[model samples]
Target: MSDNSSKLHQRAVYLRNLLIAHVTGRSVNEADYHKLRHYFMGHKDTSRIIPSVLEKHPDLSDLWQMMKYNYASHEDRKAFIDSEFSPFLAKLSPDSSQPSQALLSQNQFIDEPTLLKHWLKANEMLEMNPPVASEQMKVLLEKLCHQILRELKVVPDPRQHDLTPLVSLTERSLLLSPGKQHYLVVKALVAGCSEAMSAIDNLTAEGISVITDQAAIPKIDKPTSLVLINLYGSLASMLLSGWRVRQMLVEGNSQR
Candidate 1:
C-alpha cells in the first residue's frame, strides 16, 4: 500500500479501537488490534467505515481521557487532537471536505462606504416619516441578529430557543483575549438582542402592527446601541486583520 494509504489505515484502526474501548470499558488486546488493523489496511472501503464508527459512538470521553493521559497540559492535548482529528474527520464526510464558502463570504466585513450608504438611507426614511423608518429599522435589526447567529454557527429559532446561552457561547468562542471593554460590549449586545426579540414576540402576540403602530417599535436602549456599534467596529477590525494575515502568507509562499 502507498504511504498515505498506510497512514490512513492506521488512523482508522486507532479510532475504531478507541471507540470500542469507550463503549465497552475495556481495551482491545494487541492480537485483536493487529488483526483489525490488517483487515482494515487491506479493505477497499475503509474511508467509508471510519465515519460510521464515529457516528455510532458519539460520546468521545474515552478518546479525550486517553489524550489527557498522554499529554500533561489540557490545552496541549485539546490543540493537538483537534488539529489532527478535524482534517481526518472532514475527509470522511463529503459535505465537510470543503469549507463553507457562502458563509465565509457573508461574514466578511461591510466597508465604511457601504455602511455609510445604509445609514443615509435609514436616515432619509426616518426624515420622511417615523412609522416607515421604525419598520425599516426593525427589519434591519432582525437581519443583523440573523447574520450574527449565522456567523457564530447557531441555528436561530427566536420562538423556540433561548438565544442568551448561545450568545454567551459565541462570545467565548470568538473572543480569544477579550478585555474589560470587550466583556461589557458583548454582554450589552447579547442582552439588547434578547430584549429586542422578546419585545417582537410580545408585540406580535398583542396583534400590534409593528410597521404602522409607532408604539410597537422596540426601543433600543442607549447602552445597547453603543455596544452594537462597538461590536460592528470590532468585527471590521477582525476582518481586516485576517485579510492582512492571508496576504502575508501568500507573499511568503511566493517568495519561497
Candidate 2:
C-alpha cells in the first residue's frame, strides 16, 4: 500500500479502538485524548458521517463534552478521537491487526530515534506541563534539522535558533535539485512543518491547560496544544518518511 494510504487505514483502526475504549471506560491518556479532540470535537470540517455517528450516540457526545472542560487537566481521564490522527504516526504494515499500532509506530520512530524520543516525551507532558513540552519541541526541531544537514555532509550553523531557516536548509538538503519533480511538495511539507511548530511554540508559550467555556473566546488552551502537536507530528514524520524513500531509491540505483 502507498505510505499515505497505509497511514490512513492504520489511523482509522486506531481511533476506532480508542472510541471503543472510551465507551468501555479508560484513563484519559493525554496523547489519545488530544488526538480525539482534534478529530471529532472542534473540527467541524471532519467527515460528516462522524458527526452523524456522534449525533446517534449521545453517550459518545456527552463523553466528548466532559473532556472539553473538566478533563483537559486530567490525562489519566478519557475522551474520543477521529482522524488526522494517523498521518503523523509511523507507518505500519497492513496485517498488523494490532490496533495499538499508534503506540507501536511511535515506539519504532523507525528512522530517527532521538527526534522520536523527544517528541514522545513532549507528548507525555502536554497536560502536566505544556511549557516544557513546547521547549522540547523546539529542541526536537533543531535535532531534526541538524540531522538532515549532517546526512548531506553539510554543517548546520549552531547559532541559528529559529526554525524556519533550519527547516529550509533541511528541505534543500533533502532535495538538492530545485528541478526535481518532488521538490515542490518537499518544500511545502517543510514549510508547513516549520509554520506549525511556530504556532505551537507561540501557543504553548502562553501556557495551555484545561480551560474551557462555550461563551468565552478561545485562547491557546490545552485542546489547541494537543491538536497542533499532533499536526506537527504528522508533517514532520511525513517529511522524514519521504526522505527515507528518496534514500532507498538512491541506494537501489547505486546497487544496479
Candidate 3:
C-alpha cells in the first residue's frame, strides 16, 4: 500500500480502538487521548463521527459536553467514562486488541513545509528533463493546481468552467524574467487565495446560519485561516520552484 493509505488505515484502526475503550470503561492512555484529539480537530469527516457515536451512547452525554466545551480534565474524563458509562460498558465484550504500534511510532504530521517539500521534489524531477510537449506541461500544471486546491480545502464552484486561468498564469510565470516571474507567481498565488477565501466565506456563512454560538465562531475561523495560510505557502513554493527552474535554464542557455 502507499504510505498515505497505510497511515490513514492505521489512524482509522487506532481511532476505532480508542472509541471502543471510551465506551467500554477501559482505561485509555494519554497517547490514545492525544491521538483522539488530533483526529477530532484535524479532520472534518472524522469530527462528524463524534456526534454519531454520541447518538449511539447517550450515556456519554456529560463526557461529550465536557469534551465539546474544552473543559474536560484527564481525571474527570476517566472518572466519567468509568462510572457513567457502566450500563453501556456492561454490554460490550472484553477487548483484547491494542492500538496499532506502527501508528504510534509513525510521525505522520502534515504542514505547509511538508507539502512544499514534496512539491519541490516533484518540481525538481520535472526540471531535470522538461517535458517535451506544451500539453504535457499544461497537464502537470493542472495537477499541481488541483492538488493545492484540494489541500487548501477549496471546493470549486460547479458554475466555473475550469482552472485554465490559474494554470496558464503558472505556466506564463515559468518563462518570464526573474523579477516579472516573481510578480506573476504572486498573482497566481493570489488567485488561489481568492478561490480559497470564497470557499471559506461560503462555509462560514453556512455554519453561522445553522450554529449561532458566538464562542464557537473563533474555533471555526481560526482553523480555516490557518488552512488558508498553509495553502498559500505551499502554492508559493510550487510557483517559485517553477521560476527557479526557469532561471537555471536561462543561465544555462546564456552560458552556451
Provide C-alpha RMSD values for all models, in order: 19.6, 16.2, 17.8
lDDT of 2 at 201: 64
Clash tally, candidates in order: 0, 7, 0
What ranges in model 1 sit over 4 Å off? Answer: 1-116, 127-129, 158-181, 196-256
Candidate closer to the true structure by lDDT (higher is better), 1 or 2: 2
Evaluate model 1: give its TM-score: 0.29
Using TM-score as the measure, the top candidate is: 2
lDDT of 2 by residue, 47-116 (tens): 4434343434445557656555644422123112322233222223233342322332211223567457
Q: What TM-score does each of the candidates earn?
A: 0.29, 0.42, 0.23
Alpha carbon lDDT of each predicted model: 0.38, 0.48, 0.38
Off by over 4 Å in 3: 1-168, 172-220
State candidate 2's TM-score. 0.42
In angstroms, give how far residue 135 of model 2 lies from its true place. Answer: 2.4
Compare candidates 1 and 3 on TM-score and give the better one. Answer: 1
